[model samples]
Target: MDIDLTAARVVLLGRPGCHLCDLARDVVQQVVAETGDSFAEAVVDEDPVLLERYAEQIPVTFVDGRQHDYWRVDPVRLRRALAR
Candidate 1:
């Protein structure tokens, strides 16, 4: 499905083979599913800029293009973000 640009974004940034990243993705997916919000995934290892910026902070989540969460996803905060 195509995402609406105006909608809030749930960005999951992580690398392969990271268990924590996988868990973070799952939490993000759950939040998006509950809120029916737009979602995007960024592979830090593939993007030079993201790699440098989030090299040590994989599993980061961004809401509306702003850094929202890192290391873990907060479902309550995510839902509230979507509501706004």
Candidate 2:
């Protein structure tokens, strides 16, 4: 899901032992570096409810409290999302 940076509030749902989640974390950090926008990271396993809710969809990305991407990070879309 593409997001508008002017109003974007991103959250990365991640957990340990997840390669894709690690990659997503890197991508989000890079996006922050290039765009200077803030984002949040939520470790699903840290919260059992979150873990159960997002276990199959680790590394989920949300923009403005809405689901954007999952499983993998899409840099192109992310850049567009962060470009205001």
TM-scores for every predicted model: 0.83, 0.77
Span of 10 residues, lowest total lDDT, candidate 2 = 1-10
The C-alpha stretches of model 1 lying farther than 4 A from their native spots are: 1-8
Clashing pairs in 2: none
Candidate 1 per-residue lDDT, tens place, 12-83, comes to 777888888899888888888888888877677776767777778778888887788888787888788778
CA-lDDT, candidates in order: 0.76, 0.77
Clashes of each: 0, 0
lDDT of 2 by residue, 1-84 (tens): 232322446789887789999999899888877877778887776777667767898888887677779999888898787674
Q: RMSD per prediction, one decimal?
A: 4.3, 5.5
Evaluate residue 49 in candidate 1 and report its C-alpha lDDT on the 0 to 100 scale: 69
Question: Residue 29's C-alpha lDDT in candidate 1?
Answer: 88
Q: What TM-score would you give candidate 2 relative to the actual structure?
A: 0.77
